[model samples]
Target: MVDSLEDTIEEERLELMVSPTGGDPTLRIAHFLKPSVTSIDGPISNLPLDAHSFEDTIAKPNIWASKVAFNGWRNPQKQWKHWVHHMHSLHQSTWKEAGIHEAVMNSTFEIPRNDNLIFAFAEKWCCETRTFVFPWGEATITLEDMMVLGGYSVLGDSVSSSLKNGELEQIHEKLIQAHLQVTRSRARKADQSTWIAKFVDSGSEIEHEAFLALWLSRFVVPASSAKIVAKVVFPIAVRLSRGIKVALAPAVLARIYRDLSLLKDITVKMKTLNGNEDDDNDVRVTSLAPLQLVQTWIWERFPTLRPNPHLIENDAPRMARWDKRKKVNSENVRQAINSASEHFLWRPYAMAANGYLPCKLYKEEAEWMPVGSGLDEEVSSLARCVRVSELVGLDCTEQYLPHRVAMQFGFDQDLPGHVPRGEQTRKIAWENYTRPIGDTVLYIPSRLFEADVTKRYLDWWKRSIFGGHNVTKTAREQRSSSESLKKTVLHISNEKKADNDLLVPPGFRPKCNMVEVSFDDDDEDKQTLAKLVRKIPTESEKSLSRENGKPSLDPQVQSPSSSSTADNGTVGKDKCHVKPVDNSIRRKLAMEDSEKEAESGTFVHDSVSISNKAESSSLDACETPGLDLEARIGKLEYAVAFLKAAKFGHRSD
Candidate 1:
């Protein structure tokens, strides 16, 4: 029956994995078609790669070819493998820094000639610093030796060395090229920043300034590229002020404490509905003890192929849909890979000719693009874990999108959906428009947002706005209001000059000294100096001179002053005192002294003493109220003496 089934499959459920080289092309067989092309144990009786098998009937219960019926989609995995062969065939580059070279590449890792040297070199750079530490899966770097890059450099005796050393031999085959550098992390002082403000550091000055220049040439050039990038620096600044962290990663990921609770609930609900009676006790469970031999065989071949490089929904075998639920034709799967590749190429190709990107972009591209199986990274990432509920036995009756959050979820049951009402099925959208991929990398950190320079600049250029503006910015504005203001002010802010800016008077040369000038049409603004001049006194009226207590009434008078006595009696020099009477002219001095003393005499004692004092003073003393009070008392004393009124005839009036 098995032989009959093999013979029976003609063209009905079959597809081509690779595009046929010659002939009808329509006659190509099922691809990704894991025939016994490479065998582990047995002498393969009927290999699928045979020319005869191309036209002959094959033994399989189900299969499909990438005929027009499959929408011209080829098997992504098969095509991917097919590519690896071609790529490997053309690849030839020798590297010798760490005993790695082209001839020994398969043993260590082969370098395709076109592979980016910068990307290859970057690993060495990263090797120098223990500061930056990415877990194996974080960046574009393939996780082989459990290495991380792009943060603080490591200390010689740091904890990271312990983590990295154990896995070296396993990845002895892989090599990447990239450029990395350390920045001057010292905070600039206000005094030092003054120079930066007057003449800031140029793109040619920063250590990575050259790298930045290269990125801008390729990715952010004018009129040549196709890609999209989305950044929200200002919005991020606003959110950061509210205390969120890591703008590249979402708030939820950073605040894992909050996430763990929801994750716990989800883990519970998923375990329940997805549970089936056949789980550990399915009747179809046969003694796969036969496969135990195969499993052990594959396990022994460690450094060859990783069993689960893509560690998310589909790649992780435990999380994958049961073989029965996989309805996509193998050929259709390959086609998906092809489409993704073409999509990936669009940005790099568009920006490649421009000088902004490094020559090494293509280099890294070669290193990263392995079999088409590796290309599914776009859809298969752990970042796409949100889509996990849809792929298989996952019963998401309870699970919904967690990112489409409009507002936060106050309760546990209603998870904040990221999608809005009008676009319920769509992913959450940014409220603002973004710039093209090319224009974005023109700035410092904006391009840094991406993992590779190629993607960094290419993505940025594609995201440029309509007017060739690369408005998308680098994010994760890390501080609060005061700190943020300081950070942003370092770059001159784009504020418009106010009308009051011109209001700073241009010298003291006005047409007239205040009150003399009045005009009907001058109502437009009341701030002209002529009108405000008198209300505020001349400099002389404001201060007294020490030379004398009186102020000089001249505009250009020079006396902060030694003899200026202000109306309030404030004096500058002369030990800061009031004008004193001159005893040399006793009459005038006495009159003045008497008058001055009278004004301070309230309604009280020593009235006769004032008489005696004032009578001895000059007439100008009468000008002083104390002198008048003294004069009146002197008259009353004389009248009392003349009429003897004080002794006996006193008048109460």
Candidate 2:
């Protein structure tokens, strides 16, 4: 009777879940119906394996000349803060207009490179899946990571969208010429120093565009040279100058994936060579990707491997959590990483102290939503991240597989289905990369769900790891080697602790105290200039004050309450300030203002139309004042007539 009942329960469970081999796209609930059963089996894979090979690559006496040195971007100087200060208010207004203020703000915070930590983590990176496989499970840096850590927007026009044979193209050409004229070079490119000197405070109409161009070239997709590539960056910079948003996160992620593959290939080759080659013939690899992002990802997910980070301020970007320099001993990184399974943070952002706030992408319940279903931008962005699609970059493309790591997105895991990589799939992925596919629905899982794998998935994982392999022999050998290395490291640590009582304990790493550093007279001058700029009033604010028949109040003398009310919405008598007006209300007000302008023979494009080109083409064609008024009026009349026809046709039906 008990066996019969167990069989009945299994049948019911099978009925509720779709087979992994089935063609259905809808996600099943079977993965979440039961709790995960821990497998008693040993390490799942060779991952978190010995890191001696990677450590030895960097352990050479001339470590600075090693290939791993090129893993991260060149650190910018403290003086770079002056450039940020110069463009502070302009950047705020421009990025807000472009609908990328959140991303832009996050990009400004500097994350100091921890070379030892990065190298240690890179050893475990699997190039095929673009993930770091560990003993517990697989984890990867995804589009979500780019959005959170680097402040790149997932919802925007493709990076390949360029100005083509339009007024925009003319504008782009003129901006390119400005760079050439500033540098006085035959080449179209300009060096960073020359670009900054020419455009920082030039007050020219193209100053903002030039600044963005420099930023993209240096920070976003930098090459080995110091010169900014006008052809690659200028078009996007021009679009941004016109307040157009570009999907930057996908492209950034593609570059990271490509570089990581290259880094892995070179590292494998070096390991094979085993120091047999001469010094002159040694292979030196350089990774152009922004590896600081990879380091930050590891720091966020691995508690044991993380160094002490800086305190984060309210409303600041999460990247600000690592703004301080951290001191780490390279020697113990392998041991820490090996034992990180118990200390790993599966969902770090869910914790309030991690400095992540609930955004629009978060949902309370799991549901299927059609991509590009005229949904909110945040919802659409989240859909793009979760879907199995191809990520297009400037020079490369990569496949994204969120289904395999469903747990990372706060969903329970089952056995992941096969991902189709045929030519037809690639074509479809490219053509509809930023648009909605016909009748296709994307799974938007809830963050509130418990992230765990089903019992069947655990069993399958164990079999895959232990089956067809001599697990007994491999486990024994690995255990023996790992223990020997640990004893050696522990003995060395003890000797060092005895000699100098300052050595940290075996499993406990203390935080480094904040230290103050003195600056030069040039730094003081930059600070003075920044303060003076803050005191000056913007032209619009000055005009508004003059119209109101009152002198503008000095910013420094303004009361906290008045400034707070003006910056945010009006404050309440209660402790918490009143919520700011919703986006819907703001859009309604903007439409009303546009209608008012329209009566005066001016047609202002709405934000929605500006973002969607198909909706804006008619308005764009009528932009020139030289066009006949009757022609412009006829276009509007035709649109109104078409809408009336559609309404009457619907009513008749």
Candidate models: Cα lDDT each:
0.19, 0.52
Which candidate wins on lDDT?
Answer: 2
Model 2 is weakest, by summed lDDT over 10 consecutive residues, at 3-12
Candidate 1 matches the true fold with a TM-score of 0.14
Model 1 ranges with Cα > 4 A deviation = 1-83, 87-270, 273-443, 446-653
Q: On residues 521-554, what C-alpha lDDT tens digit does candidate 1 reach at each position?
A: 2111211221212122222222322122433322
lDDT of 2: 0.52
lDDT per residue for candidate 2 within 385-432, as digits (tens), equals: 655567877667787766556667665565454444555443355654
Residue 48 error, candidate 1, Å: 50
lDDT score, candidate 2, position 227: 50
lDDT of 1 at 110: 14
Count the clashes in each prediction: 93, 0
Number of the top-ranking candidate, with TM-score as the measure: 2
| Candidate 2 colliding pairs | none
RMSD of 1: 38.1
